[model samples]
Target: MALDEAMLELAAGGSTLLRFYGWEPWCLSLGRHQTAPNRLLGSSPDDLRPGVDAVRRPTGGRSVFHGPEITYALACPARAWGGPRAVLQAVHRALAEGLRAVGVPLDTVQSADAEAGFAAARISAASCFRDPAPGELTARGRKLVGSAQCRRRGGVLQHGSILLEDKQHLGDLAGRDIEPRGSAPAGVSGRGPAIGLNELLDPVPDPRLIVERLTDHVARAFGSPAAAATSASAGIATSAALTRLATGYERVHRSGAWLWRRERPLPAA
Candidate 1:
């Protein structure tokens, strides 16, 4: 959970941050640094089927994929950045604006409840791209972007995903009988078409394009195009902290006991 520890450091130090990242292969990422066993009862993630793997993200959100999509991480003081909602909207609003600049129209879904919680059990499908939350961008009623956040004592770190391509092997990944998602409007009923960068720009969209536009947009959103810093000199420079964070993740995230926390354990000694 690099994002989680990084948020703690940034909040403690009072720094604003942003990062663009991608997943290796096709992995399923869960929320709040949770593991697959915690989500899927009795499911074995050891073999990690050819098309499926899982990782626990520091942010709190439902499961999402690491394929043909763009992901981002940001950390900053809550006071420097707006409150949770404001900070989230700040990023999504900029993303919506940038996509619009490239000719892709989207709608922002605002939450009236604000307090209604998300249930993971109800959403076991592989398509996290279909869910919507307040300030999340959508096409008609279908989701195009999803985000989650974990606020620590100091600042907050938020991470998100934006669909860049359709789930190529949706059936094999999530399972058969899956509904359409991401740039596929065939069975989506009255939902607006999910557009991608290829549809907006003459050339196909790539990770680099997303990073460039998002970096600029985020800077502008903070009203300090110059205040935003993308250098690693800020926090990740500390070898000790880096070692601690890495160790913590390896011990908890990759460890069998932590990953399979849902399993019943023998009585304590």
Candidate 2:
């Protein structure tokens, strides 16, 4: 999360940084403004599950369990993408094309189709995968990619998840109704319907192929070039600006107080 934020802070004027990653021992991450969970459904969250950790995202969206999914984050200049809405759609559109290239049959959720149930679901669902927001990538009618966006300075940081071949088994999170989802390759917990690439293609295509396609398409669509920097220690992230930015974000993510919403503001420096 901190490194993704550092990328946002240091993104060059016209380029986008795409990051694909996973959690280290698995964790539950909350949206920036999401409250700490009172009661979590399905398996025990960090509160009940000893040793596992939880943290808050720097972006907005509902809570998401980090295991059982492939996550992507993009840090790009907002103006280049024409702001948040454009940022969301352009990326999803690009990703849809890329996924289709690999046989995923992905589609962008039309705003009109998404509006009807959005309000109720938005308030009631506790997981980001619970409903497809306008511009998210979906397959058949279930979300194939669930994303959320937040803008900072002149840049945009969007975070999303791609589910795997089986039902995420959300342990039936609270406050939602569940009907068994339709079809195979992907399933919903009490959360919502989402498809995984493995379900569509047995053994799931190598994630690298999917990411490679996503990189080429999004870079071209945004008129930007792509670069690879594997880690904060090994790449441009070592620069002073990113190191400083990462420090603050790292502090937030590491704080149990911040994670559970018991944080006290640091004294003015």
Candidate 3:
């Protein structure tokens, strides 16, 4: 979350950033404004472990269960990408191309109300695995990709998740009882209810391969060279910053006191 905020600020200052990350043991992440009261009832805070943990993103979007999913984060000046929608479409096209190269037929989503986009909750109307919208990837009208963005200082950080598996613990994540039916389309099954390269091809395609291909495609889209880096040096510096930010946000978010900060008016006494 701090990274996203920081990236947005940096992007506004004209710096570009992209990051890929993973979820361990699975976790459900909520959006900044999502209500957890309903979902938290009947659920113990301790119950979240191994595969269960809820953290709210500072971004405006719905909750997403992460595991066996490919997550990407990009922060850039809006001017560079033309605009939010155009950048989104470009990235989706690149991903579609990579999936197609591996025999996964892909298509971009078009909202029912194209003029006015769907709400974040509506994206969850069916399931992230089955819902689709502009710049999203889908198969037979089911959602295969979902993304959200935060604009800051004239720049934006658009981060999102790509399902490698479709139905894993999604129902539980949304507090629903629906079950995923049938086999998922290619390139993304098994990981959720869908299968991944690990199970689709004879010689499993390396995750590195997918990342490399997508990076190349993104480079072409942005007309810039892509480079890979590790955190050996920069990672440590960033980690310290993240730690401090997380501590501060946690106090504000986890403490009931903070929630009521704006609720009461000052006493004139």
* lDDT digits (tens) for residues 1-269 of candidate 2: 77776667755344577767655655666777677764533363334333435667777667666655667777888887677667777877777787777788665457653323333345333567666776677777877787776676688887677776433444224543322221222343323476677656766787767767776787777765344433234444546666677777677667666666645324111
Tens-digit per-residue lDDT, 67-182, candidate 3: 66677777778888887766666777777776666666554455343213434345332334434555566664556666777665588777777666554445334545322222
Considering lDDT, which of the candidate structures 2 and 3 is the better prediction for this target? 2
Better of 2 and 3 by TM-score: 2
Candidate 3 worst ten-residue window by lDDT: 260-269
Estimated TM-score per prediction? 0.70, 0.77, 0.69
Q: Which segments of model 1 are wrong by more than 4 Å?
A: 1-4, 33-51, 108-126, 168-202, 223-244, 262-269
Judged by whole-model lDDT over C-alpha atoms, candidate 1 comes out at 0.55
lDDT of candidate model 2 versus the reference: 0.62
Best model number under TM-score? 2
Q: Indicate the worst ten consecutive residues by lDDT in candidate 2.
A: 176-185
Ranking by lDDT: 2, 1, 3
- Clashing residue pair totals per candidate (backbone < 3 A): 1, 1, 14
